[model samples]
Target: MTFKPFAAPTALLALGACVGRQSVLDPAGRDANTLLTLFAVMLAGLIVLWLAVNGMMLFFNKISTRHYDESTARKLIVGGGIVLPTLVIAALLAWGLSIMPDQRAPGDGLRIKVTGEQWWWRVEYWPEGAATPIVAANEIRLPVDARTEFNLTSAYVIHSFWIPALGGKMDMFPGRETMISLEPTEAGTFRGQCAEFCGASHAQMAFDVVTLPQDDFDVWLAAEAAPAMATDGAQAQRGAEVFLAEGCGACHAVRGTEAVGQVGPDLTHVGSRKSLGAGVLEPTIANIADWIAHTDDLKPEVEMPAYTDMPEDDLMALATYLKGLK
Candidate 1:
């Protein structure tokens, strides 16, 4: 009886989880809408088939008293047991396969190359016929209504790229590249995750998906292509010195600065990112400092070493500078 009081709210809460930034049911693009439609159609068809079968059983056992002759029973068994199920299954299969080509359609001039690493994403944007790519990490931005193609590969083990609100999942393999195109119809922020289990921190590997108006997306990309903003503040200057002294440049890159290492994520415009540590922590000053001090504690088995011995003031200064890279 006590469970009855909470059942409605609990059910509602579960249903609420099905329609959010990361949910397939709450589609924000054409491919996702198609998937939702196919799922709904199949579910409805199966429900009707289930009721028919059970209803026939109910009629035979409880409602009907007269027994049918052999000929009539055989007809019922053939039509209901075999023919109906076959037709329903075939129709659903055909409809499902027919949408594949559209899902793999070519893009509209923009190509994004994403390389999956141990637990992070390396993202590059290449405009049509461009000689150079604009590199970013752990974030993807797209222009709404324009189909952008993704060239996906992995640096190590396998990883599956999936943005539930936008489209289907694609598997990324090392030494091989795969392609998928997604056209976002809605202008909003969403989330993407590595759908495959790669390593110890597989669950922590997530990325931000942002869809913007075409003009706004162009402005953002242009800014992203430029070098990092100059370090102006006194604290930022000291943080830059600390970054150099600590040999952080050997693994990270801050364009227009001495730190030009590319073994890890590019830090050219890291300050503008929404999250830090490959979406493991928020981009707050305290959180950044904490991540720098305790990388392993926050995200286990990561390649980057923790700066546990750094002085408190220097740690805070570095975090501040990183937070101001925008």
Candidate 2:
């Protein structure tokens, strides 16, 4: 027995349902769910309109053969095609707009700044009643059950910041700022990627959003604000010297040292980050060594040059020192 192909209308409906079940339509969290529901409704309405138009055309084609005067049938078809679709689409547009958040009053929420560069993210936290902002890179930690507003912008090219579990993609345009407000309803680690294609390393440009309980989040924030840990041992001291002497200082910054360049991710507390190389690889000593040795192999268009010219011992020492940055 051979299976038959599905009819066009049935196939379209099935495809629509499949698309609806995905996160882009039926999202997990509350805010995201609301947005997805609105989008799904609009999509479903459009699909219905498409089917109706095709069905009407087929009906007219059949009726014209049987009727001596097909003018009345044509008029009916044209009127229904224009007026009915217009009404349905207008209603859907109104309903979708109704659910969209009001941009005028965003309310009182925790404000954070996210700046997108070539292949990484620069995160800055401005808590309520704080003088100086807390700066971090790649990883973002948010308190569960709090409304957090992100002021997003791009340092170089246009990029989109998206954490699918929390909210929708918000574009980061150069020189101009955009805002995205979301409330993480639960505590968990969610993966985030740069939604737009920015450069050669765009595929490797990923990040993690670690959502924790309010108390845990506060503790982590306090720890992040504290001074960088001091390095001990002869290897680590030598590694620090290699890091400063070998042009790594041109891009990276380690708070208390002379490596104060802002072109690359800050290595001030890099050891504490869950993953290294913008979530491209795990934060192991070996992975760090490989990244330092062959950055181009891991990420071809990364702005940081490969350190393959460095001696193996220097590479090991540098990795060891960076791993001790917590």
- Which window of ten consecutive residues has the lowest lDDT sum in model 1? 1-10
Give each model's whole-structure lDDT. 0.92, 0.81
Tens-digit lDDT track of model 1 for 193-268: 9999999999999999999999999999999998899558888888888989999999998888899898899988
lDDT of 2 by residue, 1-326 (tens): 76667777788887665332123543435567677677779889989998889877787687645663678766776677888899998999898777767322262556789999878899888888888877789999988877788899999899999877667788999999999787777777777889999988888888888888889999998888776684688988889999988988888878778888888987889888988888899988889999998998998778888888899899998998999988
TM-score of each: 0.95, 0.84
Alpha-carbon shift of residue 211 in model 1 (angstroms): 0.7
Candidate 1: residue 92 Cα off by (Å)? 0.8
lDDT of 2 at 237: 86
- Positional deviation of 223 in candidate 2, in angstroms? 1.2
